[model samples]
Target: MDLKRLNYFITIVNNKSYSKAAEKLHISQPSLSNAVKKLEHEVGAPLLERSTRKFALTDAGELLYTRATIMLSQMDIMNKEMKEVIVGGKGEVVLGIIDSLKTWLPKLIYNYKQSYPAMVFKLFDVLSVEHVKQTLQTYKSHAIITNQLIYEEDIDSIPLYKERLVAVLPQEHPLSKKTTLSLADLEQESFIISTEGFQTRIDIINAFKEEQLKLNIQFEIDRFETAVSLVRNHLGVTIVSENYVMEPIDKTVIRRPIDHPFLERTVYLAYMKNRHLPVAIQQFLQSVEEHFSTNKPL
Candidate 1:
């Protein structure tokens, strides 16, 4: 019923022991028990079941715990926002980024710090695009940058840039001499494609499916570097974003743009549609936009 009861319930559920929860909350065990009892009474269902050896949540308890976790997080955010507003000198922003963006985001984050000097940044390197979307919805990250975008109706996406997909091929491959190649050129070659769960792999699959083409995959890899390495060793050809294959590419390998051509993946800066970005976060976003605009990677 009250925030105190909800907090007590959550702590007890998380710790899974009345005595441990009481110690963590700095309250007496009896008080903790009474608070949990009051919560269960208000909800009209038993929240926890205890045996001699262990404790576990009932179905109702599981649902309540999930709801309470989200509520507690919102409360924590509200408290932090109030404290920051009162203090007037400190702020924090969390950014979830894909691995491909890691090469450029560090410099952008560093520039943001130089300008603000008091803002704190929390960066999470995420592999899944869906996970990035979930993170934004849960308020875990204020914004996300990724080459692949999921067209969610409730999310606002800003077009950062379109990155050209390039082919990494072994030195002796006949098409390696070309300046650019198309997906059709890959028909003769066995591809070293990204694994099925990756966003890039999904995009590649969908794009090929649209053209009624199926990839002849020799191997599937999880990381861009791994795929590229296989190509370097004359294993197979790979298609990846240009940013991922910067200088010092292997001597046995050659890179060429996909010009003959499929659609270039448009990278986006995505955030929740109705969310109010804090001043520091807005500044950081602006800085990222400016960086890409000014430094056109050819």
Candidate 2:
């Protein structure tokens, strides 16, 4: 079947309604139906079960849909590569990174450009482990730089560096007097831990549990800035990766290193293990490995 019909079929399946797919595709309903009909005719088997209210894909249709999705993705990539070649545009290194890497990323890109001038960088502030995993899987980012571990089988991870996790406390907080703080020291302090789904939340929870300390969580946040903001206001204490507080330490909050092995996080460079990466992206991955190998952010 032609790409157009396969696209129409996929759209219909995604929308779960022929009329909705037609509207989305900006085509007449009958025209969309005719395209599906032709596709089924070409396949010599009914692709959809007409008896169901919500159309169901037949076995043959399921196989075709799976294959077509991959084929279309490859075709789209081919078109993008062709256009880039025509315009003398090298592919971009699309990276999803945690917030801490914000300052040095541009420098990394600038330095990489010294070797490969044509390639460009696209950076996304992907913080949570779940968000970064989805970003890589969806091809929204070619790779990810993060500290959290990704247990997914399809993603390949390169260990970068271990960053110390430190506590952000209000200057006036009792524990702020200490040079290094333990979970025991902050047991009674109002805690501002990360939200439930984040790996940081899990790590912090387990760290407190291991110390047999009660985690008095007063605030749950997704952003480190929010944690810092709350800590600055003396609302609660929060822990963060040291890289996040490296520069621009304001007077309101005090950062003290957490004195536990579990408090340290290892930064990682992660990418889809099985996907065919573009040449520039492949080069970028290599360059990233080399860059981190020499310059550990820790």
Candidate 3:
């Protein structure tokens, strides 16, 4: 299969218009259309549903698109590795990490850098596990550190650490003195929470549902820091990973563990299962394993 045609198909799908894809690809609209038709013939199926006003992919098209994305990503990695080999330099490793890992990820990277001094890094602080998975699938990131246990055929995940979730409250709040909290305790309080699609947010919602309670959500923010800051201001209480409890926080806020059954989540380090991982990535994975083995929470 022609990689160029596959790229054109991807561009068309992304732009959702033939003319736009042609313009972006610096080719004529007719030529682009013809190329797609040829591609469809080669694949023995109509890849697109062009009869409707809005463009849509056929079932076959969706499959091809998914596979082509991975294929192109692999090609890009191979090309970069080849270039690095020619230049006699270690290649780069891009990592996508969730916000909760911010505290420890730097130290892990620092340790890895000692072993692979010439390796370069690109870090993406992603908001959710979905975004991290997408980054890895698109080849924008070589590995991801996330709290969500992703079960995908092409992806492999290793458990790194487990942490409980706790309710963060203003020090002056009545619940601040409590050793443990429950969903009922927070039912009347205004809640500061992560936006939808985040695993923490989903877990919070589920915990509320389990107790047959409705949360009085006041704000939906992206980062844990924002949620914590809001709680510190007494705007609303929020739930956060226990890792934040270990951080040096403002005296105005306190964290209380939720009652049984407790809300605990495990963090995982994930990567593509089939990709030929570079030495730097392999060593970095080792560093992560070593760090957690010696330093994991009890």
Candidate 4:
């Protein structure tokens, strides 16, 4: 199969319009249509359902799209590896991490860099587990440290650590003195939470729902630090991972474990399953495994 035609087909599917794909590919619409026709002739099946008002893929097209995407990704990885080899095999490592890893990620990077001083590191802090998975799938990130256990055929996840979710409140709040807290206990209090797509936010919402209670959300922030800061100002109470509780007391914020139907999440180090990873990425993964094996904080 011609890679160019395959690319053309993938581009058309992605854009969902022959004219748009032609514009993006710098080709005439007739040429693009001819290429797709040739592809269908070669495959012996129509790849699209043209009768539909909106662009739609036939069953064969759907299968080819999925396979073609994987093939293109593998080809891109091969080209990148070849380029790295041609340039003496040094490459940058990109990592996507959740906000809770802020405390330990820097230390891990610093220790890993000591051995490979020339290695370059790029980091992206994302809130949603799906975002991390998408980054790995698109080859935008080499690895991800996240709390979401992504179960996909093309991705592999390794258990790193488990931490409980706890409630954060202002020191002067009436419930702050309690040794333990429950979602029901905060029924009257306003809740500060992360946005909907975040796993922590979903988990917190589920926990509240289990008690047949709904949080009186007053604020929805993206980061845990922001939620903690809001808690300090007595804006509302928030729930966060235990790992995110940094030292050096804020003096105004208090953290307590939630009781009854304990909310806990497991952290995982995820990577592409069959892709050829750079040496720096492999080394960093190994270092992370070794470091966390004995030094798991929670």
Candidate 5:
């Protein structure tokens, strides 16, 4: 099969619909359909089972889909390598980071750029751990800086740092008087918590259970800022990573680490283990390690 047809096949699998893939590639639907048909004929098997309701890939199609993803990625890497030979290692670096990580990332990116003047750095705030894992799996990002580790067969992680979870309470709350309170002390206390799917949520919940305490979740918010804001208004308390507790401290909000469970979140730099990273990204990784080793953010 032609490389064009293979590229089209990868797009179709990614979009999950021939029509949607056609629209994205700016090609006519009939032309895209013909390409897939010819590909199926050449393979002597149907790649996609088309039904009135939805598209499903057959077993052979699923295998081909996985292999095609890697093949296309390798081809793209080869093309970039050829270009880099002429232009040097000066391509864009796409980094996916957890939303809460923005606090100190500016410093890291600044240091990286000073060292590698030619590479353009693009930072994207990925909201969830699963999203970062998906980006790594699909070659959407060169690297991910995140607080949570997601289990994926193809991805590898480098340990970066640990972030402790601190309790945010209104300055007037009775719990604010304690320098450090036990998780058991917060049992039945009203809390503004992040939604349940987050791995951080799981960590907090497990910690509470270990302390024989039950969390009374008053509100479920998606953003870390929302949870902090609510606690500032005296709505309830919330558990948040230390990196998120930036100051000029709101006079109304007080932060204290929980002493009983003593929970801390680990941050990792994730990338596809087998994927060949561009030279610019390799230099960036080195700079990141150097920045974190000596500098402690204020």
Candidate 6:
């Protein structure tokens, strides 16, 4: 019931033994035990099963442990946010980003730091569309930059910019001679595309389907570099965001713009619609909007 007792209960569950929890908490075993007992009495549930030698949680104990951990984590986040407001110094931003956005995401993050020198950033690579949505939904990330269009009603999305998709082909492929390529043109070519859950793969498929073309997908890859490697080895071709093909781009593969309207991907900055964002995070999002609004190069 009380924060102190709940914390004590969580510590005991985490350490798995009274002696270890006591040591970690810098308290006597009896004191730790008393705290947990008080918590059990307050919650009206037997938290631990004493029948187990290594110690185990009762069904109720497991539930309490899960809830307490999440509660404590939110409390900590609130405390940090409050400190940032009063002290104007320390704060952290947890962000989820798709791989392709790395082309300019690092710079955007760096620019944010210039305004708030003490800002801490936790960057997570979220490539698959489903994974990115889950990251935002679960509050794992405050905001995300993704290549897919999320249709979730509880998520708010901001359009960043549209980047053209390009065809990556083997150096000697006859289609490489063209300045631009269409899905119909590459229908007969072996394809090395992203995995099934990836937005890139879905977009690629839709683009081809629109033209009534069938893709001969020979391989599935996660990274754009991997696609280049496969194409270089004469395995198959791939379609990906333009910047995904990093510079110092090798000669063994060639990139030509894809001509389909559906192939142009719009990057999005998405976040939980109802979540309260910390001020630092709000400013970071603002900077992104301003940059793209002015047509400044990312």
Top candidate, metric lDDT: 4
9-106 per-residue lDDT for model 4 (tens digits):
99999999999999999999999999999999999899999998999999999999999989988898788767665554256788887777877878
lDDT of 5 by residue, 1-298 (tens): 5888988998998888888999999999999999999999998999997764677898879988898888888787777556655655667788987656767777777777786777887788765777888777777788888876868878887777887888888889988888998887788678887785676788888898887778999999878788888888778888888778855567888888888444888888888878767667777876766666776662
Error of 6 at 107 (Å): 4.4
User: What TM-score goes with each of the models?
Assistant: 0.74, 0.88, 0.81, 0.83, 0.80, 0.73
Model 5 TM-score? 0.80
Q: What is the C-alpha lDDT profile of model 1 across 20-50, one tens digit per residue?
A: 9999999999999988888889999989886
lDDT of 6 by residue, 198-242 (tens): 888888898888888898989998777788888899988888788
Stretches off by above 4 angstroms in model 6 are 3-40, 44-73, 76-80, 83-90, 106-113, 118-120, 137-139, 151-154, 246-248, 273-278
Query: Higher-TM-score candidate among 1 and 6?
Result: 1
**lDDT by residue (tens digit), candidate 2, 1-298:** 6999999999999999988999999999999999989999999999999987867999999999999999998787666556655544366767888767755667777777887798777777766778878887777788898877889999998998777788998888777778988889889888998887777777788898898888998999878889999999889889988888988779898899888888877878999888776666676678778877898553
The total number of steric clashes, by the backbone 3 Å criterion, in model 2 comes to 0
Report the poorest 10 consecutive residues by lDDT, candidate 2.
Answer: 80-89
Cα deviation at 232, candidate 2, in Å, is 1.6
TM-score of model number 3:
0.81
Across 55-74, the per-residue lDDT of candidate 3 in tens digits comes to 88999999999999888878
lDDT of candidate 5? 0.80
Any residue pairs clashing in model 4, and if so which?
none
Off by over 4 Å in 4: 34-67, 84-89, 209-213, 249-252, 296-298
Model 6 quality (TM-score): 0.73
Give the range where candidate 1 is weakest over 10 consecutive residues by summed lDDT: 80-89
Clash pairs detected, candidate 3:
none
Clash count, one per candidate: 0, 0, 0, 0, 0, 0
What's the lDDT for candidate 1?
0.78
lDDT of the candidates, in the order given? 0.78, 0.83, 0.84, 0.85, 0.80, 0.83
